[model samples]
Structure formats: C-alpha cells, structure tokens
Target chain A: SKSNEPPPAPPVVHYYMNNLTNTRTPIENSETVLILTPLAKFYQEYWDNLLKISYPHDLVSLGFIIPKTKEGNAAYSELQAQVTKTQSGPKTKRFASITILRQDTESPLQSQSEAERHKMENQKVRRAAMAKARNSLLFTTMGPTTSWVLWLDADIIEFPPTMIQDLAAYDVPIIAPNCFQRFYNEEEKKNDIRGYDFNNWIDSPTARDMASKMGKDDILLEGYAEMATYRSLMSKMYDPQADPGTKVKLDGVGGAALLVKAEVHRDGAMFPPFAFYHLIETEGFAKMANRLNWESFGLPNYLVYHYNE
Target chain B: SKSNEPPPAPPVVHYYMNNLTNTRTPIENSETVLILTPLAKFYQEYWDNLLKISYPHDLVSLGFIIPKTKEGNAAYSELQAQVTKTQSGPKTKRFASITILRQDTESPLQSQSEAERHKMENQKVRRAAMAKARNSLLFTTMGPTTSWVLWLDADIIEFPPTMIQDLAAYDVPIIAPNCFQRFYNEEEKKNDIRGYDFNNWIDSPTARDMASKMGKDDILLEGYAEMATYRSLMSKMYDPQADPGTKVKLDGVGGAALLVKAEVHRDGAMFPPFAFYHLIETEGFAKMANRLNWESFGLPNYLVYHYNE
Candidate 1:
C-alpha cells in the first residue's frame, strides 16, 4: 500500500517557470497542453526544438522529472539555466509554466551508458522506472485547466514546428507520430532516414500467443529478434507521399512525441510500471487506454526525428 | 468632418455568435486573431472553408460585412442560418464570436458577374469601395486583446488548415501568402496551378515612372498589358521546392489572404480608399505600413488557393 502511493506530488519547484509576463488566459479561448518529459540526460537540441514549436508558448505548460543520478543532476543544472533565461523573456514567448521534478527514488540500474542501458535484459527494469517517473510527472504537473498531455522524449531532436497544433487539430483521444532518425548508409554513401521508435505497433496473433504463455513478470519487448512478436510496427509504415493526417489503429504506443487528450488521463489511463497484457510502460499505457475504451492512433507519415545516438 | 466618423460602431449585431459554451481565455495565454472578410456575395464553399480553418476557434474572432445589394441580401440570409446553427453547437468546435455587420452604404459597382467585375475600367472604383468595407470591419470588431488581423477574401476556398497558426508563427508585422488557382490548360490538356493574385508584387522603376506621368486619380492596376508595372510578382515567385517560411520584401500586397500584426493596424496603417502612392485598397495599406517602417513580407511558396471563378 505504501509503494502504491504516488511519490508525494514531487514538489512543484517552479510554476510559471517559463512565463515572464505572468499573463493568464481563460480556459475557453486557450486550448492548452502540458508537455511531460522524463529526462535521464539532457540534450540542447531537445530544448531548442521544444522552443521552436509554433504553438502559442503561453498556452503550453511543461513538466519534467530528472532521475536521481549523476547525469540527471547535470541535466537539472543545465535545464535550470535555460528556464531562468526563458522565464524572464518577453510576454508572448514565455510558456505558461515549467515544472521541474526529481524522481522520488534512484534509478534501478546504475550504469547510464547506452550499451548497458539498451541490453534486452535491462528494458523491463529500465522502463518500469521510466513509467514511475512519467506517472510522477503526470500526477504532479497536470493541472485543472490542462486540455492535452504531450509525452515528449528529451532526445527527440526535431519535429515539425506546427506539430502540436497539427496533432491537436485531429481531435483524437490519443495519438503518436512516426518517430524517425537520420543514419548513415554506408553503401549509399549518404545519410538516410529510418524508423526509430519500435514501441508503436499493432498486435498480432503470435504476440498474443506469446503473451498468454509468459509469466507475471515477463514483458513483451518490441524490435527484439529473440522475442519475435511478429507485430505490425508503426515505424515501418512511414511513407513520405502519404497524407500526414492518415491514421492507423494501434495496440501499443511509443512514448516519443505522444499526444493525448487530457480527459483520457483524467479518466484513469496511465503508464503501468509492471506488465499489463504482456506490455509495460507506454505500451502498457495503450493497453490501459484500450481497457477504458479509448482507441490508440498513430500517424504513419507524421514524422518526428529522434537523436540517433 | 461628420463623414469621417466611423458609422456608429455598426451595432455589434452578433457577438459570440459562434461560441455556444461562452468560454473565455485570458489575454496572456491566448494569442488572438480577428479574421476580417468583406463580402459582396457568398458561396457555400467560402463558409465551409472558413469553418475548416484549424486555428483554435475560441481564440479566433471573426468579422464579416456583407455589401448592401441583392446578392448581399441572399448571402446574409444564408450566412445567418449557418451562424445560428454553429453558435449553438458544441464548445470547442464553436468560435469565440462571429460579428456580422452590414455595409453602411451600397457598393459602387452593381454588376456581380465575373466579366463585369473584372473589367480593367472598374479597378479604381471597385477597390476603393472594398477599402471602405475593410476599414469598417477592422475599426468595429478589432478589440483590445486582438493580436493579429487576417484579411481574408470570402472566395478563397482552400488553404492549409493550419494557415492561421502557420502565418502567425512568422512573427512579422505584415505578410501575405501567394494566392493561386487551379485552371484548365487547354494546351496541356490538364488542370494546372497558376498565380491568381497579381496585386502581390515588388515595386519597380518602370512603375514609378508610369505613376509619375499619371494624374492624381489615375490609379495603377496590376496585370494589365497597356500599363505594365514590370514588377516581380510574388505570385510568380512560387516554387514547390522552396521552404514555406521563405519571405520576400514587397511594396504591395493582395487581399485574398493577408495577415497583419494588430499593432500595424493600431499604428494607423489602413486601406486607402483614394490613391495613395499610386495604389489603393490593400496595396495602399502596404504603402502606409512601409511609411511607418513596418516591412511587408510575402511568402511565395506558402500558397493558398483562390476560387477559380
């Protein structure tokens, strides 16, 4: 029961952290979104791209939680400097708020290196901690006036400037854009774009069968050759010629650039730290939303580039 | 002196005409825009396209003034019916307000036919009357909180759904996207897109020379064989490969879809009903803005389709 209690609303250390003018708009005219990010590390590109978003800054609230680790501490200091500068800026450029939160407990795994973090064995524990951090940020920063929640990964380097307005215009309950990255193609002698987010996918009979046989602690990880879920991955669906508004039904969702209606969250949809229907974290979030009758959607051609590293 | 008085605020006949829930957003959080359209006749396509704009409706206030004519009466009836239906609709779908005003005076030109209206001889009178109508709408409906003013022609049937947000993101004082139309090319035996608004152009030495020789009332009209301005038309600058944010300096602008910062209008930039710098109406407004040190910008590749008719 004590573990179930959400880490005491990780103190709202900063409110209106991005707003210098301190201008407040009523709920009717402003359709607002709270951007939730879980940071294990900070990249300047991520912050730059966030500021490049064309959505009215004053209407966008931000929530971020850094892990209680050395890298996260460094990220916290860097993020704090940017927030201070942006918070004192002009009226229209300022965001409604920036909520900085620290994870209640230390991350399960000690190493922050990519090779160790990306190991198939580490995913279950890594994501469970990530889900907790997300839950902490969501429960603490989401406010009464928030209309939408955008779960953005700190490593996402580029997205359409109008991504927020473009996604919100669809008026869907929950949606994610196709995440992509630029990688060097040795044979082609040039850089090429490829899908980066494997979490977005449609369920398959094989995955269902595999899930039924798994134990309570076992999780279904995507993009792993060993697991062989045989699911239809949303990442592979990107077509440049296809209309960006094209939508496909999805059973699993990637956390990168996910946009969701606030009502979906208020109605009790959240990231499950443990396995749910053989899925964990964001994928498990889709399961929870599905249980609540809210469908998960993916825009195959609406691409947001993630940092390749 | 009495004629200069603004037609007594045109009786705000309809306020919040589109907002059913009557929601209100604060000035700080909501960057507001007023969409002003002067209508002599209305097509269902116009109203439908207006509704299709993806801008947050609650932050968009609309102003429409139908001319005093037989066609105007029919448009008013049709527009009123649609407004009544939309005003009572769901909350987020409805606009903040739809202020519909009837022109204080009858239009100078009576013929609504394409052939009669497009005659080169009617250019001066036609544009002068249009200038008056625009002034009336702008002066009456623009409130203290309004941040931008979009001069949209009713017949502009298609545009990127996020046009408002896209245009506002530029943060320029005054800007207009290239207006184009689809036309059948007899030689090519296919429909092709062609520049439609010749009013958007760069000033030239030839145009200045031509203007100096003309009498005070002799207005310079673009797209005429006899009076060549030899200007670099913005409409001709459209290139599919260019970035959408590309902006070019201009001494003139078109009214099809002009976006202006509210401060420009508040600072006394207006449509000149009479010849001002050898231009009238929208182009004259650009001249006034230029005189006040606000540069005019045209997005050649950012095209919005005008009604072919």
Candidate 2:
C-alpha cells in the first residue's frame, strides 16, 4: 500500500495533427488524434481530407490563429465564426468525434523582425500548443493504457485504414516510415530522381572539405542524407545487424511524421519545444531514446507521401 | 711519379727498446724516456710506485715488461745476469747519464695460479725468450715517438722530477720521469729512512678501486695508479677540463705507468688478448689513447718504497 502508486494510466492511443481549421468531415474518434496548427484559410482542403480519413483512434486537434492588431476585434470574431461553422456538421458518430481549439487573440505576433529571429521561436509556439492538446486528451480519457501517439503534418493524406495496424506490428518505442515525394512528374522522373536523392543524401565533399575556409557567419544546410549514411555505416561497423537490444548510435530521425509510444510522452519524454520546427526535435528525441536504451526503428517498407509545395 | 709518399706514416709508434739496453741510462739529448720491466718479476711493484706522485705537466710514461714465458730460454739467462750483476755506479758516459731500466728474471708462476704468480720465474728456463723481450719493450717504447710517450717502472724512487719540467718546457713529442719511492718506519720523521728502498708507490683509492673491482680478471698490476684514477673517473663522467683536447672514453689505465699522444697507436687501437695476465695492457692502452680524439697525461708528485725481503 504505497501512497504514490503512479497516476492512473491514461488512454491507449493519442493523435496530434496541426492546423485543422478549414476541413469539412469530422474525425471519427475525436479523442484519439491531437492536432496543433496555425489557423489559416489555405489549410481548408488539407483539413477536409484529414476529416474523411477513417482513423479509429483518439484525436486532439488545436488551431492557432493570431488575430491581427490592425483588424482589432474583427479578426477574433472571424476566427470564432470559422471554428464554430466547422463544428456544425452532419450528426454522425464521426462528427461528434472532433474537437476544435482556437488561440486567444491577445497572443498575436508583435513584430515581423521578432518572428524572424530564429526558427526556434516558431517551433516553441507549435510544440507548446501540441503539448497542451496532448495533455488535455490524456486527462479526458480513462483507464490504464499503453497508448500510441502519432504525429502527422497538416498537409498530408492518410492511406489505407490499416496503416495504424501495420505500424503496431513492430513493438518498438519509436518508428519512422519512408516517405515518397507526392508530386512525381515525368520531368522530375527523367531528371534521375535517385541521383537527386543521392545528392540530397550525399554531402558535397568539396563543401565539407572547405568548411574550414568558410566565413564564420556563413549559413550551411548540412546534408541530412550524408549524416544518415554515415550513421548507418558506423552502426554496421559496431554491429552488422543493428539489433535493438544492442547499443546503436544515431544522429537523429526525420520529423515530418513519427509514431511514438504514448507512455513515452506521459513519462516526460515529450518533444522539446526548442526543436519543434528545426531538425533538432528529431535529434533530441533520438538522444532521449538512446539515454533510456529504448529502441527506435526506421520502417523502410512502410511508405508515406510527403507533399512538398 | 709520386705513388709512394712515405707510405702514409705508420699508425702505431714502434720503438727499439732492446737497442737501448747497452745504454743503461736514457740518451742525454733524448726527448722521450723509455722504461722497460720484465712482467715475470715486479709488475705489481712497478705500477704501485707510479701512483703517489703528481708530475709537472702533460708527460706520459709507457711501461714494458718481458712476458713470463721468456724465462725458459738461453737469452733470458744473459739478460737476467746482466740486470742482477749491474751496479748503479759511474761508468761509461752512455751509462752514466742514461735513464734507468729494470728487468727481472722471467717467471714460470705466470703460468700458475694467482697466489704463486706474483713471484719471479727462473730466467734460465724462459720460453720464447727473445721474442717476449722484444715485444714487451717494443710496445712500451712505441708510446714516445709520436706526439708523446713515456715508459718507466721497477723500484722507482721519488717522482715529480725534473723530467716533467723538461717535457713540459718543450712542445716536443714525448717525455716521462725517473720515479722514486721512500721507505721509513712509523716512528721516523719524513726525511728519515730505513735501509730499505722500494720502487713501487702507494696505491690511491681510485687505483685500488679499479684494480680490485674494475679490472677483475685483467692484469691490474700492469696499470699506473694516477692514470688508473683518471681513467676510472673518466669512465664515470665526461670531464671537460681533464680531457680538454680529447674525445676518447677510457675504461681504465695501465698501472705500470703511461703517457701517450693522441695519434700514436691508430691501427684500430690495441687488441685485448683475453688472457688473465695480458688483458689490461692492450685494453687500457686502447681506451686511453688509440680511440679517436684521445690524449693522455700522468701526474708524478709522490713516491713509492720498494721493500727488500
């Protein structure tokens, strides 16, 4: 009879999606998916597609719309009107599953220069909103559960309804799916996409060699593909199999989409706010998993399409 | 036309000490002193006396002794009789002014064990009589003809004689003194002397150390005391002052007495015979002067007393 017998377990599944303002169909299980997004008219089509998806999991969606100061209270009224209109849908079980969250108008961006300071501030705002939605969903759900938390970018479309089932087959703490480019055109295909991909993956040897020659203020986008290849090579050198039970060193995983164990978030393994936008968020999560000796896998088989516009 | 230019000068100094036998004293005009002793009789006594004195300048004395095996021959008889019957009195001019040379009966004890080896052998039975005598004196006299050399031993009296003044006064090739020793009872004053007179000098701590510890199986008695001290100290450390113009490192010095030029015995130095009695002679000579950049000196201040039993 210990006094602290751990807080009662939360829901087994939680989903967080960003910017769900202009969608039509409501998510069937509103308690499963947790969404965090900036409120904007351009996200309408993307939000509608998410609503139509047959996601049989809990969902928590949030919208961040900073009202313009010049527009005064008009902007606030418009945001509330749009949110309410989206909620007023067909009286189906799926429609009842959706939840709408709006940002307070007082939280508007003060200055453009301030917003341009660094990518970190923008990521902080997004990560804070997502965390709030995740906690709210967990608090409302009941029972002891080994929940799964799935994060999806706002503009993507979900494929087969069994996608979640396929992901659950692996009993790992974290899993990353291989993503394909959504807009694969003939011209793009003729341009040797693999070569382009290789270029993206392989760092320019010259650039890397001459890095010492660069000015201090020069901005560099280090090639992620090269980093991945190096990590893979180094892992093989340590152990060819890259076994989950064996210790593996990894730089990071990509952040476009990731599925994590719900307990990891509840246990304070939440994504760091500082890295919310930049690639560092993925790296930080990987580092945390390494510290805990938790397993993370990259599912080269499972494919997802990323729309890069 | 000039294929032969004095045959490139002999690397070793070779003197004919046997020729000086008729002339008991050194030639009046001679710049170098050549003393010869027969190894069979008084090798130990000869060197022991050279240690006590400090000579004036850079004077070297080379000691030569006929090998003990020569005592078995007919020639040994003539030499032995001549030395014993000879008296220290005024005679011919050549004998009157010449330096002293002492020779003893060849010893058979040389072939025996250490305890009996110190005594003189029967001169009438010496083996290889003439050859042994020639080589012994040859090796000793060779020291003078070069830039410098000295040969003396056998019942020598007081040292630091005018020989040092004569040698140092000139920039000539070689020089050595007629050494002497004093013998007096403990109760007698310094000037009072008993009837006995000994040729050998008192042994220095360094000479004792070298003869006992450093020489081991070698013919230690054939080494000079002062030279042995300098040699032992030089072996321990490089002294810029004592070894001013030399670069040779010596293991030890011959106790029988020595002084030599740098370039005298230049044919790869002397050979170590490895025999117990003859070992130190060549080894000591080579170490002190034959090696590259070597110069030698002997000090002659005190004297040794030769006791007659």
Candidate 3:
C-alpha cells in the first residue's frame, strides 16, 4: 500500500503581491494605494481616464460600489465587461486586485430619475446615501498593506496622468485638487473652462456665524444663494501662471478627488452620514479629521476636470 | 598604494529581462515580443488604444521611427510628451523599454500637403518610403531574445484587448487581422461600418495573369479599377455570425496589425520598397514569405478598427 501511494504534490508560487511590511507613507511606489470610486452612472470616458493614470498598476488597488436599483444593475453589467477584459489577461495587465460591492442599505431616493435626483429637496438624503456607500467601499477593501486611500468620483473624465504621484508627493494627511469643467462659451464662440466644485474652501466668519445659528439637525451646503456662507472656495484659486504644487489650508473638502493617508482613516476619519458640526459628507469628514488634530489641505494650482453633465 | 586603493564596487541587480535561452515558438508569455510602429502622424487615439492592450507590458518592447519633416517633427513632439508621462513614473508604468529613431533617409514626397499625399500618382513613392521606415524600425529594435514581432500602424485606433495573445495563439509564421472603419451613412442617417484596408487578400488567376504582363518597374495596386487584382480581400470576409478565430490562407498582408514569428524576419523576410512580382511594400513582403516556403494567414472574422481620417 505504501509503495502504491501517489507522490506528494508540488507547491504553487505567486509572483505578484503587496509588501506585507508596507507601513510607510505612500509617497514611494513601494507602498500600496487603494482607489475608491462610488458609481451611479458608468461613463466610458471615466473608464478611459482611469486607464490613462500613470501610477504603477501593481501598486494600486481598485474598489467600487453601486447602489441597488434598476439603473445600478445596468451600470454593473457594463462595468463587468470592462473588468473582465482587463483582468482576464496576463498578470501585469491587471491591477493588484479589484473589489466591487452592492450597497447593503437602499436609499429612499433610489427610484428618482436623474433630472429629479439633483433637486435641492433631495440633497440631504442623496448625500447621506453617498457617504454610507463610500464608507462601505473603504472599510471593505482597505487592508494592512494599503498605505494610502484615494477617493475618486466616477464622473471625473479628465485629469493629469501623474495624478496619484502628484497628490501623494505632498505627503499631507489629506489633500484635494481644484475641480473644473469645460463648457461652450456662446459669447466667445469657443470652449471655456470654469470652476466646478465649490465644496473645497477655507472657513469664513460669515459661515461660522451661520453655523452657530443653525439647529443640531440642519445641514450646510456650499454655493447656495439662499444660504450665503461667503467662504473662499478653492475652485476660484486656480492660477495658470502659478506653480502646480501651490498649497493652501482648508476647513472643508470635496469628494470629486480626495487623497488621504491610511493612518487618518484608521484613526476614525470618515464621511459622516449625519450632520456633524453643521456639515455632512465630505465636509463632515474634514470636521472629523480636524477634531482628531489632523489638518486638511488643497492644491489650488493642480487642477482636475469634472464631467460637465 | 594598498591603503589608497578604493574598495571593490558592489554588484548590481536587474529585475526585468527576456528569457536568455528562449528559442521556442512564441505562444507562451515567457517569450518576449517586439512591437514596431512607423509614425508619420501622431494620433492620440492610437496611443490610447495601444495602452489598452491586455498583453503583459514587461514582456513587450516598443520601437518607433519618425521621418524628418515638419509634420514628422510636430508628431514626434506630441509623442514624446505622452512617452515621458508614461515612462517617467514607477517601473510598472513603463514598457520594457522604448527605442525611437529619426529616419536617416528623407522621402521626396515628405513635403507634400495632406491633400496631395494620397493621390494615385504618389501611391508608389509614399508606400515605398513607408516600407523603408518599417524595415529600419524592425531591424534596429529586434534582438536575439525576441520571439515575435508585431508590425502596427500609427493610425489604427481600436482592436481587441487580447489581440496579441489571440494572434499568437495560432502559432503561424505570419498572420493579420481584417481592418475596418466607421463612416457616416448619408442614406441611413446613422453611423455605418465598412472595410478599410484592402491589402490582405488571396491570390487569383486573373491577378497572376496581370502580373505576368507587367513591366519590371510597374507597381500593381489593389482596389484600383485601373489595376484590378481581383483578389479575395480579407476585409470582405467579415461575417457577424462567424467565429472570431476563423482563418483563411492569404497571399498578401496589411501592415495595420500584422504579427510574425521572429524566425521569419531573421530568415530575410521583409517589405520590399521596390516592385517584386509586380507588387510593392506589404504585398511584396508576403510574396517574399511565399518564396521562403512560409504561408501567410489572416483572421477573416477577427476585426480591428482604423481611424477614418
């Protein structure tokens, strides 16, 4: 019986892996970075721009979350086709790995059409749902080897190819880029660019005065004429003649493109679904970080373009 | 003297390399592949599509040659910007290496305007210069470790991500894919697709008869009524219901997306800039391969899209 037994099996070897001891800052390519994107609509341009990133693929991980709805299902199918085509090839053609999730909790505004979803009446519920989605994707995909986390929006269609390296080079606890968009200029008869995200800004005396008068359950919004906060927005700070590395301190941040050190998130910085210091979502995350004694920053001259629609 | 002598230098290490003893058929990922592209005009779509390829980047080498002309110089500058953005980051963000050459010999028609470049009278001269460019790029970049060579065109905008693996799976000495383009259909009020490259085809009795009657200096042109070859073009063989792997024997080949075993080129197969058997350029290259007893094959159903302009 012993003589007739089969030989022992051979060991399998894996060639690609994140460094197990990677606990350093993510300024170097040796440290792994996690990119988290919350998807509502899957645009081909967004996928194309993602592929255009010049960061090393082996050092980056991707995570996505789609809401549970009819439109969400269609987006998932389209996303699957791209993922399969990208990951089914040789080891070098794929990212470190990809993780996708469906939201566990459904939003009350999930059934609203695109035209109605952006109304002022729906902003509170819509943003709360998005905050939960980001936390779900972040907590589920991040691991000990992940030294950095980048929150990239799915609708961002254009950015510099060296986005990750440029953002991480600052080595700040957290940083946000000035987001802008291109539009047709009827008066000039040509295309023109304008600031898009008003969420990133420095605190103003008028904003603090307004927050002091607001109720505990109230939420503050940026760029609203009805609620004049008079904050200096980072979007308005873009100077083409200035150095791209120009930096500024910020009390609020936007979700379009935010880079954070893994330690900041580990210390409990998160996008709060409820009103925190009269702010919610990305601004709430900034408030939480400040409460933990970690400062937020912005690159006024380093620009990223958002989808016009 | 002994006290003043410098200590012995430390040894260096290299992480990426082609298999040194690799002489097998190149159907496996372990073998190295060299991609050669002769550039006249630089199209961003072509570069983007090249990046979308799912093949292993570490196992592939890239070669390019730009002509010496105003248009060529502008294209080179545009290409260099993209290359620096891609290759200046981490090691994984770059190809194995890129070798770019400035074509030594200038073409007589290099100064022709875009409108006059494709006239019937200029076809022979234009294509001959293109052939020379291809030969220069190929011979310079391919080395002993290279197991395969892919001749790609700069204007080809789209193809399957698995193109390299799919074409190599056939293990044929030389193979090409059917090239098509998208055009506006005036009658249908919609975008329509049609074959673009008519070079890849099978020999016919009529074509052979015409070749026999041609002078040594005369060049035969395909898809031209004045010089009808009556060949069965691979472009005309596309069938929606047919399998993508369907293959057919080919007597002529196109340079848009051609794949060849390294041994074929090593054995003296090349694009003839002058008339050979009444054919020139890619068609002449196919004729040369036939003389060496190597058959050319085409994937009738596997299609690649080219830029219309």
Candidate 4:
C-alpha cells in the first residue's frame, strides 16, 4: 500500500504542452470553457489550484462533484460560502456559472479472493460512475458556445495558472499533459520525481495477451503493471526523450488534467460505465472516442503535478 | 434477511391519494411533479409502472438514480430506449423530461468482525449515498414551479395509474403510503400479506436507548431489528390493523412511494446523508423535516404493493 511512501518532492517547472509560441491567441480566441472536476478529497488544495487557472473567470464555468459524506458535505458548504463571498465582493471576479453535485464512494473490501473480485467490480463501477458523472456534467452544462471541456482531478497540487492557456494552444480534440508526483526518495535522502499517471499509454503484445486471459469481470489496468506489460506512459517516454515538441499517441486518457474539444463529446464519445473491449471507464472512453473518429494524444514533456499522498 | 418470512396475502385496495373523481383537476392544477426512483433492478416493470401513471405526460418529470455497474448500465440503456421510443411515438405519451443518474453500492464483507463493521459502514454509507443522490437530484431539478416531489422505488408492480394523483390528493407536506410485498409461505403453501419496507417507523424509548448505547458508527436499522427495540416499522403495525382510514405519526420515512411538498426541500430541509438523532438517510430526512416545522405522516390503511422477489 505505499502507506509508508516518502513525502512529495519540491515542485518542478518542466515546460511541455504545445510549442505554440503565440500564447496570446489562446487567451484572445478562448471559447467558452467548462471546467469539470469530480472530487472526493483534497478540498482546500483543489480550490486553490482552481483559483490559479489563468483563464478569465467570466468565460469559465466551474463544476464540482462532491461525493456524499460528512467531509464532502463540509467541503460543499465551505466552497459555497467562499464562492458566495467572492461573487458578492467588490473585485467583480465571478465565474460564468458554478454547479455542485453529489455522489457516493464505497470503501474497498479486504480479502484475497473476495477482495480481488471486489477490486475488479470496484474499479469497473467507480470508473463507470465517474464517466457517467463526467457525461452528466458535460451534457447538462454544454451550451452552443462551449468550444472545449477540461477534465481535472481534485488532487492536482501544482500547475501553472496558465495551464488552461497552454493546453488550449495545442488545438487538439483530445489531449493530456504528462503527470508526475514528487516524492522524497529516502534512499537518495532527497526528493525525486516519478511519473504517476500511467493510464495513458501505448499498448504492447504482452499487455494484449495478459488482458486476453482475463474473465468477463477481470481487467488489466495500471495497478496490474507488475503482471502486465505496456510500451510506456507518456511521462516516462517524455522524460528521457530529445524531442519535446512531438505528441505521443495514446490509447487512453486520464482525468488528472485533460483538454477535449466539446464536439468530441457532442458527437457521442463517452466513458462507458461498463467494460468495452475489456477496457472500462476512462480507458473505455478513449476507445469510444477513437471509434467516433477522435484522435487522442499526450504531451509527454508538458507536465502537471499530482498531489503525492 | 427476512428470507424465511411468510408470503404476502392478496392485494388490498384502500382508496387513497387525491380522489381521481376530479382527475382533471390534478392534471390542470398539477404542481410540477418530479417522480424520483433509485433503481438497481426491475427495469421492465419499473418503466411499465412509470408509463402507467395517469398524470399528464407533459407535466411529469421522471428521475431514475442508477448505481454504477455493468448491470446498471444495461438497465440505463434499456430505460433510455423505452423513453426514446415512448417520446417519439406520440406527443400525448411524453414525460416532461427524464434524467438518469449513477451512484455505487458497497460490497458486503466476509469476516465476522470485519463484516460487522462493514455492516455498520454499509448501512451508514449506503443510506448516506442514497441521501446524497436524492439531494443532488432534488437540488439540480427543483424548478421555480416545482410544488411536489414523489419518491418511488423501481420494483413496485401494483398501483392504479392514478397513484400519483392519489398521493397528491392527500395534499400533505410529507406523506408515505403503506408498503407491502407478496410472499409465498412454503409451510402454509399459501401467499400471505406482509409489509416489507419497515424503514419507516415510530421510534421507541427502548430502540432509542439501544441506538444511543451503540457506537457512533453502529446502527440497528433493518437487520439489527431483531437485536434492538425502541423503533417499530409501520409495516408491522399496518398488517394487524383493521381500520380503513388511519394515519400514523412518523419520525422517519422511506422513499418507497412518498409524497413531499417542494417547500420543505426549498426551505433547507434535505435527506441528511449522515445519521441525525440515531437515524440515517431518508429517516434523517424525516427528522430534518420535522425540525423544520414540517410534519411527517403515513397512511396505515392506504397501501402500495411491491413486486415479490
């Protein structure tokens, strides 16, 4: 359980998103933005990170999905209070709109066989729920003017306030930045960085074979990396590569921080709440998008830092 | 698990809800009706019962809360097909709108101690999740014109199409119909009438004491009823009573066919996703409502029959 894992390393600035030299165009030509996040924890940090986004508040809409619990309720109420105060204040900074929704999370079971089955079901169902949630938020809020949708996780601790502008410069239908979490390497006696979000990766023959032997309810995701083989996560490939401008083709995308053209979703690309081609949820979403003619790519050198536990 | 309980007897029709004699009044004076159902099964029967409602097609909005799973996805898809088909077939057969949502169910554990703790968490978290899902739906969909909200389960099979009208006729702020499920007694070889939703009940001093003595994380809702006293489900009282027009005061309420005035929710009353005064979820909602000056009552004579499993 990485419960004894070292603390996060200091934040690093490794610029990599798109090579668009003209960052001004992104802000000027910015279409209506809908920022959607499904949150379970890290409330304070999540709100602070949100405020750091460089996008203009008037053109951006904020959507939060807080799962049901005492903690979640507290977060929702507190966020509401903060938003209300900000809206009524003299600075005149206000979002286009804000919507808060509620959901629930199940505690993971502890057992061998039963836990394995529970793990599979939990993974499948949780992703499906997230996909359903993302879809619900997207469809309900997407208006005629919405040009892009950005998916962000609540636990992202570090990103340039201009992260939105950087992704917008790429002009991709679906794209994700390299994700890394800084951790103190006790052996090295110093904080070191490691690629964390590996959900987006190139498939390999070994992975296909491993996935093939699984049962109807079984899945071969990143957590099973020890048993499965994959070519590389974009973050890993980006770290040692010479070319930072090139985008890596990906078969899947994570919600950690992703930018998508609103049309891809409007055209019926969605995260399947059930397994599709042995992939479920977000990965299933990547499959669904590819089937619907949307190409997905990742910026390996361009990075976002996930909050290390 | 009430697995060995006696069979439910023949269906009883106690005339209730708003008298349909002036059925047109219900349609004309319809308060933007929102029928909320949290579903995991009985897809076909649910849709059939939904379609059978005599309320004006244009005034009634259908909301189904589906928990995340492969099975739930199938049900969601099936219901979508049914809704689309019904919507496109005739203008007279359309609901005002239909919204389907997703949540997750917790897996029961295997060990004795862990299972007990899991049981406590399951009861608290599952009901809390329901409360959260219910609140999300209510807040998201409650329009300025919405005057009433009806809570129904998906498995209920027997009810007059004018059931909504009947419940609305009661014209109370919060009211619950008696719930009964039919079961076959193998020993008696005869079907018996039994009330199944004992979640709605009157609190007793004995049960309250037991609940208080228990840990904050512990509850004695349904399964623990055998071990704890102080609360008795209205279903138990209804079965033995012969009166035709009797109403019982309740400190708790279930979603199995309930009618609530919109103001109660608008005025800051909600289904507390956590325990309130030893009650959780829907019951907590009942307590919250009473605290807000809204009275809760259930008709012991007027009944709704659930499909026997």
Q: What's the TM-score of each model vs. the native?
A: 0.47, 0.30, 0.47, 0.48
**Per-candidate TM-score, first chain only?**
0.90, 0.50, 0.89, 0.81
Candidate with maximal lDDT: 1
Segments in model 3 whose C-alpha atoms lie over 4 Å from true places: A1-309, B1-29, B111-115
lDDT of 4 by residue, B1-309 (tens): 111111121111111112211222456654467787766664477678778787886777777766565655676667667877886677777777665544433322222232453364456656655665665555444533345688888777766687777766766678898888888878899987788677788888887788768764465575463566657678877744577557788888888788887656643456655445667768877876775478888887777888765
**True-vs-predicted CA distance for residue A127, candidate 1, Å:** 0.7
Question: Can you list the residue pairs that collide in candidate 1?
Answer: A25-B26, A26-B25, A26-B26
Among incorrect, acceptable, medium and high, the docking class of model 3 is incorrect
Residue B78 lDDT in candidate 2: 46
User: Interface RMSD for each candidate model?
Assistant: 24.5, 55.9, 28.1, 25.1
Q: Write the per-residue lDDT of candidate 1 for residues B34-120, one digit (tens) a residue.
A: 788887777778778777887787777777878778998898788777776776777666777666766546688898776787789
Per-residue lDDT of model 2, residues A1-309, tens digit only: 111111221111111111111121223212233333332223344455545545542333332322224442344455445445554544231222222222222333343332342244344454333333332222222111223555554434433444444554565666655444445467756421111111112123444445445453222223343323232321112222444233222335544455565444432333322221122234444544443345566554354554444
Quick one: best DockQ, which candidate? 4
Q: How close is candidate 1 to the true structure, as a TM-score?
A: 0.47
In candidate 2 chain B, what residue range of length 10 has the lowest lDDT sum? B1-10
Consecutive 10-residue window with the lowest summed lDDT within model 2 chain A: A192-201
lDDT of 1 by residue, A209-303 (tens): 99889985689999889889999999999988878679999999999889987656643466767676778889988986775578999999998
Report the poorest 10 consecutive residues by lDDT, candidate 3 chain A.
A9-18
Per-residue accuracy of model 2 over B38-88 as CA lDDT, tens digit each: 334443333433332233111223333433254323333443343333322
| Higher-ranked by DockQ: 2 or 4 | 4
Error of 3 at A46 (Å): 64
Q: Model 4, A1-309: lDDT tens per residue?
A: 111111121111111111112232556754567787865664566677777676887667766766555655666677777667655654436676666555433323222232353354466645655665665455444433455678888777787788878777776678898888889999999988888887888777877787778774565676453555765667677655566656888887788889887656544455555455567667767876775468888988887788776
Pick by TM-score: which candidate is best? 4
